[model samples]
Target: MNIVKSVLRATATTATALALLAGPCALPATAQTPARPAALAAAQQAKRPNVIVILVDDMGFSDIGPYGSEIPTPNLDALAANGLRFTQFYNSARCSPSRASLLTGLYPHEAGMGGLDSIVRPGLGGFQGRLADRAVTIAEVLKPAGYFTGMAGKWHVGAQHGTPPKAVGFDRSMFQKGGTYFPDQPGKGRTFVTIDGRQARLDSPEVGKGEWYASDMLVDWTVRFVDEAKVAGKPFFLYLPFTAVHFPVMAPADEIAKFKGKYMAGWDQLRRDRFERQKKTGLIAADATLPDVLPEAYDWDKLPAADKERFDTIMAVYAAAISRMDKAIGTLVADLKARGEFDNTLILFMSDNGGNAESGPDGRTGAAPWGGKYSNIFVGLNWATLQNTPFRYFKHYAEEGGIATPLIASWPAGIDAKVRGTMVREPGHLVDVMPTLAELAGAKYPARFDGHDIRPMSGRSFAGAFDGKPLTRSVPIFWEHEGNKAVRDGKWKLVAQFGAPWQLYDMSTDRTETRDLAAAHPDIAARMTQQWNDWAAKSFVDPWPNKVDGGVIKGRLEGGKAPGKGKHGKGKRKRAAQAAAGA
Candidate 1:
């Protein structure tokens, strides 16, 4: 039955891809059914093309220019102009969970990544960084298929040495043990770990110089890897999870200058302008109502002179970071085209999570607690609101602003340029990437590997959508990271934060989630809540076993607290010790 299903799926996919290539054609016998391509049917399948998954950190749905932000993301805009861009995609509400699900094709908890700031420790059950040994990563699965896999940028899933990218199957890796940026650190000057069996810090002092932009560093490495792979005649998997535009707002001074006075309009006017652009560009539907402007907590007109100056500087720096990242992406794409590998390479770009609102309305300007080495400054809620544009809440919540992200997939060989301007409204999530990539690569997903029983991937392949076919998720999608829970079935999404009442939305009509349908659809809400609970239980979602004395977990800048001080103090201390030992 599985084999039969697979064959039918392949046939349908081929037809869809061909139909896209042939332009408009007569409707198939069933309007809902996909059309198969004759060329794809006759062609013998070749080895999988190289996969480049570029995951950016803390980017909002509308932060990119194509998505209606004022930010100049020309590179991302170009990708949208030439490939498939998704409008109704979702991700876990926060970082680690999103990365975990993207890599393992399972909910974060199911993959042993369920909380924030929890480093993964070896031999420790239910801690972050543990990839459930049972779950197979894309790198591991692709290794046997003869693909050279490499990853750079953030690796938040685990900080333990043994579980770094190399252990999971990457032949090469240069990644940050945690999500951070440090322009002052010595050597790679960027606090990063290089894993090729053993974790070693890169000893390149050039990394600390003001001239080094982390985004460019990652892209340079990617280009080198691509060149090497081509020379070796091998397909490669380059997982570039960039930390650009995250926080401590660092970017080239020139990039920062481009937007010097751009954000003088403040978030209020900036958000309004972005919404208008979204409507004009067909990024959002014409009838879609613009969310009410967030009420001003502080009267900007009445702000003290010093306060105003600080606010403006932070916003400007934040914008600069985004612009610089965009420029770097353009460079990477250009390199691919120059190398003649652009057409066939499948490029997937998305954010690890939504815009961060942690800085509050006032931006944070100080050395990150882990020391100024990891970050120089932090942008708070005021800028976060602009980043999240047209959505409510921010990172760490299951609201649209937190989980919704722009997903761009570009491949000259697979996607139709004519459809480049179109948006796929079908609801997709991070977990879907694994299966989608597997189908595209014709890679097999094993039931068991490395002496552990693997859980079947909960995500269904979305390759069908590339050809304009509707994607049917086999299981209701679920999420449970740090008590931010949600369940999506069809167009309806049910969600709740820790200690909050469950809220529901009809994603088709209310993707921004301004309306709470829980009151109108009690029965549907009940079903979704029950499903979320069931899935959460199966995935081992639980609150931290210990509590901070004042609900304060020490910040890394303040010398992160040792494990086991407050509630789960022992657990925390043990994990910290393991992290120190290079677990």
Candidate 2:
């Protein structure tokens, strides 16, 4: 019996050794098999966490409640309460460039959206056209890894007839052509869109009604996509870029009614209140200062009564629109929880640019005139000031008010609750999302995909932050659009407006950029400036000439009126009549 038992024990030992040799584990005899590295083990167990990126259009750094605004964004506050909030998150100061950087994991110029253009036109030197066929998006990299991808929002990277989301690797897409909320405009050629491709249109009058806010529509489509993806048993990535709180200041009447008198205290007091709240919430430093009063053109107290009312109403509408957006976000969160996907999903919420202050001195909102060049319902400048609360400059500039944003990321299954409620001061940008998602999903970024030789990713992954580890970025981040440029290497950032001298700041101590350290740190500033110049020479493309000149008027309007419009006098009208007669 002892001999038989010995034979059985020997057989069992042999079987165990062989199994270990063939499987992930190795036999004890096989030269001490090493344990898997922590990073590799974490990547293997990533489970392709469902990715939902929610982008709010034209929202300011302090727009949300948790970010120290008077706005009642309970849903967004709830998101921050349950997730990680980033105080130093950033994006480009404008729309198209930010989207371009976010998707391609490269600087805006590297992705071919060097500057804003409604359409690529001739004579634009350096305008590389839309997102070049060479850039590889996150969708393209993740699709082959058995993940479904969909985008339902603003896709402003390209505007040519054939350059919709599908052409850029999105499996299912529903997006608008331009950046406005004009669904009633002619569908095929007149700008406003409700289509999947270039041809499809929403025939239902329900959606065509003027009351249908763009944010609500976007959220509806997003929720439906989530449901459909779950039914198909496929993990999905949904990019919902809602065009809310942008110009035109339109919202459902009911939502607008809630905030009718909310801003009657005027921007001066409101800015102070918001700034104090931000300090109390620990969102900003105690030493931070309120921006100096705006230039004479923006003196709120000097405006006429009618103008004040007009601006007030416009802001009221804007606030209502964002509140509705918050409600929609709440519904989406509830839906995800209902489906049992909330715990495992990685949901990220951010704005595509800082609050916009593009309204000209004449109070024209956005790029288009109200009633569009054809109507009288123009949005005024009051709302623009309110949009960029507690900040100096607005969209199109490189100031903190224009570029800073709030980022909230929630993942119950992966992020610890204690760490979730904490605010992270590590600086991160929109360009980092693609690589981070790729690393978290264990997906490879191929050298070539779909007939394009992709450029190597310029962004480093922040996935280490999920496990509460310090994130270290090695490369210097750069930005350029229409000649506005910036470079950040650690705490030092160098910036320059178009046609202006470069300025430097130590972001660690002066995030609001009150002090320019250009003279103090001349060597560091010069080195960083040279670095940006080198990057620009490589990635630079000239702005689209025709569209560029059409959008922004170079200098401020004189005499408080647009060019070609005569002064408010009969002599000006007579000169206009003479010119018409000559024509």
Candidate 3:
């Protein structure tokens, strides 16, 4: 909770310190990244070959068609079919942190959003939910390098009380600051669509009486921006974070009907079906086994007819949402192809994290969390367990199911065709995104931005893998969301739930984490334990309080001056006086 005046400047020795902490920068394009194509000169790359990062929110490992879901995601599937699908990619186990890491090129904690923008103080680095000035976003980095950056959809990384996307560097944006299942839903509509700095009222026309859906709105804005970029003939960096397939599921009526009874077969069979498809598609080994559902759901057949019907419709709605999102993307890609930008566009598709098992305010009180009669019922735990398929657990944990994300990279002009439509299993994480894009765009991650020296980005460039090169990593990737912690080094991964002992597994063999080798390999466990502890200490890890202990719900930002206790009160009163005078 150490909020203070924004002055965290790095000293003259920052580069040396950051370099030491960051180890080595993954450069030269040959050892780590793919060698640059001779024909695609830096000048040529400097202009065209746009970058499009499509972020899917709260999606599971096996949700889309390419990832072995029955849901039709032809556009996403085409990305996998024409590009490279990653069999072992990772997210930061939740929404905000993942976005923070993806955009910042640092660990989420380094970006000051170790958690959502909920601002729960004194609970580790997560409570400070916004992009720290030091960790400049890709938009920030690329803009000065001459890329027109635009963002659409979720901006959960900084809900409000932080530097906005435009302030951080997006030139134009159509950002729905948060999300709504339907704009017409009661207590809905809170999008902030801006051209430059002026609000365009994409939130609501008159409040609760409109034809608006988050997914469609995002696509609409994205298309408009892309068209503008094309007209301008500038290589644009489009970060379209989709709010689809999350919760309070809403879709067009026709799309909803298309998925009616789709999940009537129930969770049991759906899990097996998706897993088998994954195996066949070579996304997983043929011998991969379906994990036993955690908490063990009741048999679908044993449920009452009414209850069964409810569950079926719930899943159907979820599937329909995905289908609807895919269709919108199809329209976008079609538009891109028509505009002749499809082939040259570097499209990266990713999910924030695995399936969600969260029960929103609607479930808790029979009313929407925002105090509305909303029908966007959470998918709940049973279906979520199935959503994760062969993986275990759900979002918010450092398990495979929580952190694993489906990543597809499509670039007709860049990715080698021989590797197109293939799967790359070399492990990578969200932190790799900024460095990868920086290398691709020839953009420099500044040593300094806004008075603060950047923490040297803690990711090896994975651009080398674009040309079918095996992605290599010399350093272990680490994770800590809430108190859930883990460390992945090479083939061995040591994971643990909050307040639990570490469980070691050879991930190359047990990617599903079906067996724990910690008991057998005492020495390895002890060594990795120390390694994880060192990582935790260096990575700004902090103590997380358990709710049972009754930690403070919210507290003053740490290191901030006391409200009326010093000279701070004068500023607050001055601001209040200005507002009182209508200024």
- Against the correct fold, how does model 3 do in TM-score? 0.84
Candidate of highest TM-score: 3
Pitting candidate 1 against candidate 3, the one with the higher lDDT is 3
lDDT of 1 by residue, 273-296 (tens): 888898898777777766653432
TM-score to true structure, per model:
0.82, 0.82, 0.84
Off by over 4 Å in 1: 1-44, 117-128, 177-183, 186-192, 195-210, 292-296, 367-375, 544-583
lDDT of 3 at 401: 88
Worst 10 residues of 1 by lDDT: 574-583
RMSD to truth, every model: 9.4, 11.8, 11.6
| Candidate 3 lDDT score relative to the true structure | 0.70
Task: State candidate 1's TM-score.
Answer: 0.82
- The order of the candidates by lDDT, greatest first, is 3, 1, 2
What is the TM-score (0 to 1) of candidate 2? 0.82
lDDT of 2 by residue, 296-379 (tens): 224556555655565566567667767888998888889889989888889999887776545343444333222232222223
Q: Clash totals for all models, in order? A: 25, 3, 6
